[model samples]
Target: MVLVYGHRGAMGYAPENTIPSFRLALEMGVDGVELDVHMTRDGEVVVIHDFTVDRTTNGHGYVKDLALSEVRRLRVKHGFGGKWGPVGVPTLEEVFREFGGRTRFKIEIKRGGDYYPGIERKVVDLIRRYGVNAQVVSFDFDAIRTVRELDPNIETGIIFIGRIRWFLDIARKLRVRWLHVSQDLVDPEGIEEAHRSGFLVGVWTVNDGEVARRLVSMGVDDITTNYPDIIIKAIRGA
Candidate 1:
């Protein structure tokens, strides 16, 4: 069976990356949750999608410049538009503490203009401390490589916007076992080739029921989306 992961925790129903969102996704029977992480000014590992708080939160500032206290003060705005109550941005530690061992977590390490120097180590440390079933992934090849260096036991994957041939070589070099591709770039032949090369294929941000079923038919190992319930129903033929 293909695993269904809530893309930023059922983002279609709740604010992306907030605790409320994650809770909702878990309640909907998702196999896992995917979230992005960045380091705050004080070196705290915080969970929010963008490099800045402008898009998802009430406040406006670059996340790298803001302290954890500053980030916590901002309320996350609803993605699908409704007056949901204030939702504070969550720390990586808080998430692990709350949901650890309950489900799988796909933590994507995000970088803005430059890489977060020690962010990988901090993330790895948290995973070890909590003993959660988690994997660290990123668009930054160096970041995932750093993750591998920090802890070989912690699983890592590479995320790319479009199809790229060199990713397989990069994955092999980093000892990565998973390849996260954009939904449009996945197909049966590509998936088969990835499997032949010994990598699990996961596609992102799929919301259409028809597309979900087609990808399932194409043999995707994982399907990530903003609506876990919809994907679950599509996969189960409900």
Candidate 2:
């Protein structure tokens, strides 16, 4: 079966990475959700995309520079004209507590290693504490490597935008079972190649029904998208 994950929680329908967005994705019947994480100065893990809160929220300053309290004060800027109403940045723990059992999670570590020392450990600790089904993934090779080091049992994935084979060596070193590539890379040959190499392929940000159908036919293991409902319907041919 081809699993569908909400990229930043059905971002096409709600504010990306907010609780409302995640909840909406769940309502739409996504198999899981993919969200980005950054650590506050106080060592709290908050969910948001950019390193700075300027783009998505009515706030300023880097996430690393702000304390958890400071992050809580900023309301997320909604795309649907305040339909989500005064949404605040949520902590990873908060998300886990509320929705952990409800859906799987693809937790993307925005920065790890030197940039966010011990972040891998923090995320692993949360996953363990919450006992949720989740995978740690990142664009940074070292980050997911650190995640593997922190907990070998935890599943990890490499995210990149390029040819499928470009990250194979790194994926091998990390021993990751998932290779999450950009939507542009989805093809029958690449999917077959990845499967032959003992890795499950995951494609990202696909919204069009035709494209979704193509990926499903290509034997993709996972599809991450801004619109899970559309992809769900597309795959089911509804």
Candidate 3:
């Protein structure tokens, strides 16, 4: 059976990566939840998609420059408006404490331009501390490699946007067990080859019922969707 992962904790229903959002995902009975993490100025790991809080929250400025106190003060914006309310940015520790052993987690490390130094180590430490079934994934090859170097026992995956000629070979070189591919780039032939090579496949941001059914039939290991309930229903109906 294919696993269903809630993308940013049912982002379609609640603010992405907030406590309420994650709780809703758990309520939906999703197999797992995927969230993005970035380092705050105080060296704290907070859950939010972008490097800056401008798009998702009422705050302005880069996350890397904001202390945890300032970050917590900012309220998350609801649905493309300036309506900032109660939901604040959550820390990695808070998330672990809330849902840690209850479900699986695919933590995407958001890196590039002012990326957090030693974030992989911090993330690995928390995962180990919580003992949650989780995987660290990043588009940055070095980030994934850093995870392996720090703790080979920790699972890691690579996220890619477009097609690559030797994707599996790259995965093997990196010693990653899963590939988080973009939905448009997924092909049955590629998925079959990946499975045959002992690699798991996960597609992201998939929300349509027909597309969900098609991917499930193609034998994807996990489908990360914003609407976990919808995807679960679609998969069951299939």
Candidate 4:
């Protein structure tokens, strides 16, 4: 199967990274869920894409400064006509406990600029504990390196955007097997270059059928989307 991942747990369908979004993705049969995580002030790893909860929640402040209790108390914002529920910020451990073996993950660890040290180690431990390798994503090579050190078999993709060779060179040097790129920024040349070098190519935030079809024609292996239904439909010619 050409793997289809739910970007932020179907961001288009429900609040990003909430249980509702995750449930929708699983219902749609997505191969994996791509979520971003940040360390709270008290050291709990919470799942959220943005560095702060201000945009998505009815709260203000950087995510790193808030404790887990504060974050969980925050409510996720649902757009007009969308259902607003208390899909409180969930802990990575809680997410794993709920969906661990049942679903795959592409865990993106946010960089907090030294506000939190050893977070990479803790996040790596959670992935290791779940025993779901081939289930994490990050732009930080350090996170990937730490995860690799703990368990060399876990699949970790170094995320990059904009230029092709910019990431290709690093991937080659770091032994990164996957190049997770932004759908709009990636060109056929980039995909070809990565593929030629024996690396798997994946694109993110893709929701349109035409673009999805075009990328598949170009040999991209994964398509991460806020609309898993749309992507899966496009891929299956439904």
C-alpha TM-scores of all predictions: 0.95, 0.98, 0.95, 0.93
TM-score for model 2? 0.98
Regions of candidate 2 where Cα sits further than 4 Å from its true position: none
In model 3, what are the clashing residue pairs, if there are any? none
Candidate 2: 10-residue stretch with minimal lDDT: 185-194
Specify the poorest-scoring 10-residue window by lDDT in model 1. Answer: 111-120
Which residue ranges in model 4 land beyond 4 Å of their true spot?
80-84
Residues 1-238, candidate 2: write the lDDT tens digits. Answer: 8999999998999999988899999999999999999999999999999999999999999999999999999999876986777889999999999997999999999989689878899999999999999999999889988888889999999999897887778788889989998888666787788889999999988989899888888898999999888999989754
Higher-scoring candidate on TM-score, 1 or 4: 1
Better of 2 and 3 by TM-score: 2
Distance from true location, Cα of 89 in model 2, Å = 0.2
TM-score winner: 2
Q: Model 4: per-residue lDDT, tens digit, 1-238?
A: 6789999898898888888788889999899898888888888888887888988888989987898888888888778354654667888898888887888888887663255677777887887787763355677777766666666666778888675667877777767678888887888887888888988988888999789999899888999998999889988964
Which residue pairs of candidate 2 clash?
none
TM-score of 4: 0.93
Model 1, runs deviating above 4 Å:
79-83, 112-114
Provide the RMSD of all predictions against the true structure, rounded to 1 decimal.
1.6, 0.9, 2.2, 1.8
In candidate 1, list every pair of residues with a backbone clash: none
* Best of the candidates, lDDT: 2
Model 2: per-residue Cα lDDT at residue 159? 93
- Candidate 3 residue-wise lDDT, 59-88, digit = tens: 899999999999989989878344324788
The lDDT, on a scale of 0 to 1, for candidate 4 is 0.81
Clashing pairs in 4: 134-155
Runs of candidate 3 exceeding 4 Å displacement? 80-85, 112-114
Question: Better model by TM-score, 1 or 2?
Answer: 2
